[model samples]
Target: MDPLYDRLARELRECIVTGVYGAGERLPGVRTLSRTRGVSVATVLAAYRRLEDDVLIEARPRSGYYVRNRPTKAIPAPARSAPAAQPSPVTGQELVLSLVKASNDPAVVQFGAAVPDPSFLPVRTVERALARAARQHRNRAAAYAFPPGLPELRRQIARRMSAYGCATGADDVVITNGCQEALVLALRAVTRPGDVVAIESPTFYGLLQALDSLQLEALEIPTDPVDGLSLEALQLALERWPVRACIATPNFSNPLGYCMSESRKRRLLTLLGARGVPLIEDDIYGDLGFGPRRPPPCLALSEGTGAEVLYCASFSKTLSPGLRVGWLVPGHHQARVEYLKYVLNMASPTVPQLALADVLHSGGYERHLRTVRSDYARAVGRMIEAVTRHFPAGTRITQPAGGFVVWVELAPQVDSLRLAQLARAEGVSIAPGPIFSATQKYRNFMRLSCACPWHSDVETALARLGTLTANLSIG
Candidate 1:
């Protein structure tokens, strides 16, 4: 390499190593960088040219230069002569762990977590129920938790499922650590590595995480923001792929909050059942619909299918997320799910499950959800209106029937990751759109949580977000 070329390559490589250029990130144009750094355009071009030749950067026509794909830094090897520990069992699950951790950083505003407002939850009522359970099981609190969760709690879950038109008995229900674990158990019970599972596009990240851990391939079906998955697209996927299972959120799906129409629900179940595709319905947010009446769950809608829908739900969303109480109504796969649930973790927390049962039996949980639904509805309206008024023209937002999330579309020039960083500096947390995309296509979109108190400060925060959005360069 020429001397200048060598120097430029070294500098650019160092910048990339230090995250100045960053992974999957496009760098400023040569002319712009030259102007900022007071270097000759030729020198800047030479640097980029050398970097490209070295496979350290790539040029996209009309899109400027981007850092090339580089392997992540390997862990430093143990001291050269040290005894090598046996390599940890490799499961090919690193991607899932990385994505899940990225979502948990406290610095971010947490539009990513499908959590309801704590203020809206009946915390006091739950506390009281806990108190009652403590008194009732004072001596028992020292004992090991009941396997598969408390029997009465399972019975309570069964009663609620009855409202959805599924007359499932408590014996068929297996309580797990949370909805996530319930999903993992169902997946483990029905699927093995290399099995293709169908999922809605932009589906719940947790579900994706579970699938990734299982070493399963997810075939995404195009989903409508307002109507859940497209039946036609799903039919095509089913016909084209040998899918072992289908995992979906038919009511108030996370991120998008799309509810499948009852007619579509019936049709989808019929179609999947006909094709022998086992459906895993995540109804965690079912009871939190903003409207007065709740849509019957997909499991309820799949009543006559003789056991096709493996329904899973939890109070983690509507109640205390920390409680980590959830269940799986396995329908046709009941025995398998129950056995897997036992093998995986054995059971959920005994005290919390018992307390939740008491809370449900006493009707406080219903009242709490009613309050959450009303407040969340108002917050959703306020957010949608704010996005419309504050965002630039052509911005589109979802009007979900329930839940406190709104998906906003921005002009293509606005990269949400950059915007989220800017928003965080202003004491606001937001979920960037890329986190929800498997293919990372929604750089200009974001998901906002309306689960916070709609107070003056939050209102100002919303306006500030709008201002940031409006001032974004569309270059």
Candidate 2:
């Protein structure tokens, strides 16, 4: 269905939920709604059909659609994190190792991977773009493309970055394999072995892995479920320890999805600048925001502040992840990052760059973003609703403003690793909380990915997880 119809469906869903149209009330006729909303009759019908699929409304044989009589449950977000202020080396790796293995298993209902399904991607468009790019650039398709990547792709990226308040040209953007490689390059540019880097308590495991690979110590900072990394904790940590750098995901961080306010972003920049510690920002989830406008990356606010923030992002989330395309905007470390890029893999693939540039230049990616973002919002809502209904009371889940992943904090009596083991026995997979912490904190928490296409099996998997959690709590 067109994104236009999805927007219409979302608006109607809100109206019904907010009691603008009471339960069992008949909705306007498709033709009438189409006329009123300035959309085609087909669009309105599609919208209604979608709502019916979601069981939000029902279609009568001789009557128009009516709202379903399902009661809404209020689920609360998790409390703020208060991890130990001291920096610690990543200790155990068993939980992440198990999650990594589960993520690739075909039989397990996949919630372990923090990635959207193929249904969320623009498969045909991307294929067409790739084919066209290879045909058009037949001469350069096989070449290395070298450091800083293809100029045209960088140019298109630079253009998109302008909307989010980042001021940069093609010269500043260095393409990498994905956001992971971008992050590795950023960490390398700023910190050395044994350097203490501050991070969110329940952070992305990938970041922890990178820090471990570089032999960097991680100072897990206190993070709010609503706000992002705590500046006060970071300030105190800076004062207490010899912190070398800070890494964060201010916009829709993994596991715990929360976008830092603009004021906080500026304050964070100033705070880091004062301490002479650079910030390696993971903006991978920046484009997936369920808002009117994309939140500005800290790099956007760092333009004139002289605060060095290594901005990293990728098309993996918004576009095709298989392409392995990502870029970085290293403020002062551009030269070193590009050199590291040269040393690591020589350069990113040439064809994907050309293809992405083609897709961006065509201007269809934004439309694609609208569809995926709405689909994720809908999917996340359903997943949260299922958790509330199936899981025990006192369960606190993160209410993400963007991104498909959410953090669930279960009762202290429940151990996420044990829950994960039990859920896997039932052919379900999840990222247990212990994997997200350097000091093995959040043992009772787990992060779930709502990127899968909703279906009965997926619903069953969540139910099984809830059952396992209940069993674990009892044990």
Candidate 3:
């Protein structure tokens, strides 16, 4: 109905499949085709059109179209049976831990490690507060804080969280050394080793490290580049596996920088809640969003009777990673999680806890976060601009709403591991894609850290990487 080429293309497509021309055979000349088929030369052209459209044949200049060796569609018989897929028995912990240790080497620019530049942290503000708090409560510093965290600090957290619509109280908070310990304690309280847990396909490596240490099994769900894990795939996993809990990052996720949509968030929570599955949410980067305010936490979404979400976060990403001050809002699992925290670490260090409390209560911490957020936004933008100028064609970079990590997909020819080694040899370290994936699927992907100031040298390094990729092309 549209044109002769369209109809001819369809006819040629079927003719190719029906074996009018055998494999490795050249098709008849266009004029001969017109005479044999008794159709216009245009109709013959249209038939060959369909063949090329379906990739069944190729045309050569100075030569006619030739039949390709591609196999035609055939019925696929069912297999007799296949073994069920279980988690891989091998442990990736040592490999990852070694990489983590090596990434911090001074010779490396340390893009692999996600820590912010030390120069950017609010050291002076923290020090002043520590001095004032130490003099005021020197005796209390020696005494142990309560197991549920210091009341004043908890109140500050609750007030801040309440601004985002999360209804929490100091009575429901459990403080731990860092988000790592909080996550581990929550996992310990809710699940045991060998318990199946749903995780995003390319999730935070630290969480993988945690699951390895705890001996939990992971079922990776396919996730989007901008949003998080697919709800349909997750529902399928829930129907298939006995998933005890789910671990996700609804805010700017590490390595991916995806923010799950509010609609998807509600659907995810309700779907998982219905299955009686608990959610272990990591919100460490929530406060670092490039926008005015971070998205709401899953703990805030909890309602009466089915509060299965366990929210965990730390000030490390914002104020200081060394402080190691983090908390858990364990909806419905508060008491059990607190007991686990006590048995695990006794309590977080008293000096840092009170110092954090003093700084937060006095209103210096939020100001520091605002400053850091502004700096980080610039850093992320500069990195993205550098990537667009330097990366290969067909390359797409993640434009995170917040956080300083950018995920890059290189052309398939460039192996990230190889690129990583090359970058390392050149005095820069990068996070390879395999570590983020349980199946190591993203062989050509890499992550760059934008926490450092964007310097000419960094841009030059990216250009060098692009050159390296282009040189390695087989073409």
Best by lDDT: 2
Q: Write the per-residue lDDT of candidate 2 for residues 1-475, one digit (tens) a residue.
A: 4579888998998898679999889999988998999999999999998887665788998888998775366788888898987889997765677776776677888888786788889998899999998898898997998989999999999999987788889899999999999999999998889999999988999999999999999999999989889889889999999988899999999989999999999999999988788988999999999887889999899855657888899999889888999999887788999899999989999999999999999887987997778778877877787898889888989889999998999999999888888888888888888888998898999999998877789888888888888888888
Per-residue CA lDDT of model 3 for 1-475, tens digit only, reads 2356655555665566568877778988899978876779888877776565334677889999898764243212111111123343224434466556755676566667788877568888888777877888899888887688788888888888888888788887888888988888878878888888788767777888788788888778777767677788889888988888888988988877778777778888898888999989999999888776678877777674363888899998888888899999887778888788787767887788888888888888887776677667657766765666666666767777788898877777778877777777787777887777655656677788888644556667778877776665543
Give the distance in Å from residue 179's predicted Cα in candidate 1 to where it truly belongs: 1.0
Worst 10 residues of 2 by lDDT: 92-101
**Candidates, ranked, TM-score:** 2, 3, 1
Candidate 2 clashes between residue pairs 3 or more apart in a chain or in different chains: none
Ranking by lDDT: 2, 3, 1
- The candidate scoring highest on TM-score is 2
List TM-scores for all candidates, in order: 0.76, 0.93, 0.78
User: Cα lDDT of model 1 overall?
Assistant: 0.73
Off by over 4 Å in 2: 1-24, 29-46, 58-65, 68-73
- Assess the local accuracy of residue 273 in candidate 3 as a C-alpha lDDT between 0 and 100: 83
Residue-wise C-alpha lDDT for candidate 1, range 1-475, written one tens digit per residue? 1256446656677698679978779988888988887778888888887566445578999999998765353212111111111111122223334333544564444443456657767787888888888889887655646455678888888898887688789887888888999899888878899888887766666776687678887776677777777778778777777889988888988777877889999988998989988899898889878666889988777768543888888888788887898888776677777667667666566788879999889887776775567556656766765565556666777778787787777777888878877887776777776665444546787788877655556667777888888778454
